[model samples]
Target: MGDDTLIDQVRRRYLEVNGDHPMSEADDVYVREHFVEATPEAMALMLEGRLPLPSYLLSDGTPMVPAEHGRLAEIAGGVDRLHDWFVAFWPDDPATAEEEWGHYLSGQYVCLTEVSPVRIRMKTRRVAEASVAVEILRRDPHDPIGRGMLGQAVDGVLAVPGLESFLLPMTAYDRLRFGGPTVRETWVEAPRREFLTPVAPVWPLRTERLLLRPFRPGDEPALTEAWADEDYTSLLLSGTMNPAEVAEMVRRRSEPGDGTFIGLVAEHDGEVVGDSVLILQGTGLSEGEIGWTVMPRHAGRGYATEAARAVLRLAFEHYGLRRVVANLDARNDRSAALCERLGMRREVHRRGDFWSKGTWTDSYEYALLREEWLAQQP
Candidate 1:
């Protein structure tokens, strides 16, 4: 038989052991008609047991080769030798893993050493010991199952010595293909200098009729009353707060950081009548949301609208925000109208966005672009 015929026979026998029938002459003709040449190195690697046959044979989802089960029978040494081979082949320095050889192994591109009797399985371990659950979970942060698995994996790696001091958390790619996690370093770039600057809270923002400033200790009485209002509590502040709790809220607002907290106190006659805030969302975005509440007695007087507009101006003008958005209940026409008056356009109407009063309610999103605000500025 020619080299091509020999390889086809080997491939057919290999598949037959896994319960696939051998291909006939007609099948061989079809395969040859469409066969693409494998690189010399790839073919050599396959012959030397450093790589498995082409993945097309195993496309059916069943294990074409019993990788784990045949380990002992195929190799006299067992998993320790396999482990040693990986450790030897794995770069001692994590930086080297980024090179072509490293990339091949890291990416699982080179399927070296098929375990005869058992199909050889491969896995990449996370090189760093740090828990990256927060980073991964941030995008889908609320997924309890994903969080749990990530936590378990990190803790498992940390339990082993030498793996605990990594700067970033490592990910296990192709867990099913590989019996264990393959270790690879997670690469993270340093933040730019601008990201490290301290961000200031919005203060003394002025609308046509009101000045919105940071919260003060003296505004507790007004805040307590505002919190007690049924409409304010139901629509905005759903949680019950006592004097001390409200004081804590004020304290957090006054705390400084690039992520500054902003609390607004609407003053008409040297007395606090309304409260609003423009807090930076913790995700490092330049945009923020406006949250506010007005005393029931002052509701019709447009205190909330004035306070919100002041906060919006502070966000766009002073904070250099690209955009600012507000999420409010779709049914709250009063608040919705206030958003429109401030030149914020409705961007989205989320269906079943929130659960309240035992049922899901839609949410309305209002956003104002910096360009729009600048154009409107007189």
Candidate 2:
């Protein structure tokens, strides 16, 4: 309830650590305050109980209940599943569901389904609610039907039986959505800059538990083992290849003048645990693509993360590449999570982009710019 924004706190902390050091202000403190505020401002009203809250909060804000929600939690353990859910969406911060509960929880949050965290059975509720808030905000801002649906939603909350004061916020939001009277487009200007191109891919990268270096002919066996498993191949663009085929691939990539693709094998304790690739894209060396395959036996050990991150460092810091990207099979949650962990943002999710393994396959495209990559580094 204080006026101190997150930037103010950060600035104060910086000053404390720097012994009263002076730093030039980018803009007025008032102008910068908005940047530190919690996003989707409208949702914060209901979430914090300033406005009426609805009970039926879907995970994706679909406005319906999912039958298997509780069942999936039962299968995966409530705490662990919730933690994974949070980490998958927000990879930069290492905090889990339990740690973020106080930040998202408000007394007005209501429960409609037993499977949902709204039932107050676990630490996952606040995260689920926050996710719902975000999803709801993504709906079309000017859809006429939205007014009808949201009106129905408002009536559905009548069961909560509160004072009439909260009704005004709902009506106000409806006006904002249906076309606020003051709504109009405004033009703003920004400094123009020249287009920048990044450099070439660099070499042997190191991580905490993994040493990522160029693939050797001797790596065919380990690489084949990792790529041949059914569980692994079933999620790849080319599904279910045999060990022999994977070995041939290793040989092809191992050959000289195969500068198009560079294979980096992930070595941990002298054992091959995974393989990551950096593929130069287009005639221009400014863009690069990445791919990874980790051994089934080594799953969940963070080997994929270490390998991907090291290669990313090479692509950005050493190679001066402007952009690095990964294309992942949509069903491969682990790979998608690894991309997120590498600070890559999901830019595309193409539906059924290809047919593979006896079914249509979708793909997720994640990317990071050189500037973004640099910001992540120490």
> What tens-digit string does per-residue lDDT give for candidate 2 at 1-378?
333353244333323322332212322231122122222332333333332222222222211112332243354465345435533444554564444433222212222222233333221322233234323424632222332232222222234311111221212222232343211110000000011123324545678888887777777777666565677777786766577777777777666553657777888999999888888653224568999988889888888888888888777656546688888789889889888888899999999986777788888899998789889889
Model 1: runs farther than 4 Å from truth?
1-193, 196-198, 257-260, 282-284
Q: Which stretches of candidate 2 lie over 4 Å from their true place?
A: 1-203
Best by TM-score: 1
Candidate 2 TM-score over all chains jointly? 0.46
Tens-place lDDT per residue, model 1, 1-378, is 366654565455335423443344553343334333343444344445444443323232211221332234235464335433443343564443334233232223323232221111112332221235435444653333333334333333234322223322212222233444433232211111223123564356666777777776666777776665566666552666777887777776665544555666888767677888776542223567887777777778988877877777777766656678888888888888888988999999999977876668998999987789889889
Q: What's the count of clashing pairs in each model shown?
A: 17, 3
For each candidate in turn, the TM-score is 0.50, 0.46
Clashing pairs in 2: 198-320, 199-320, 200-319
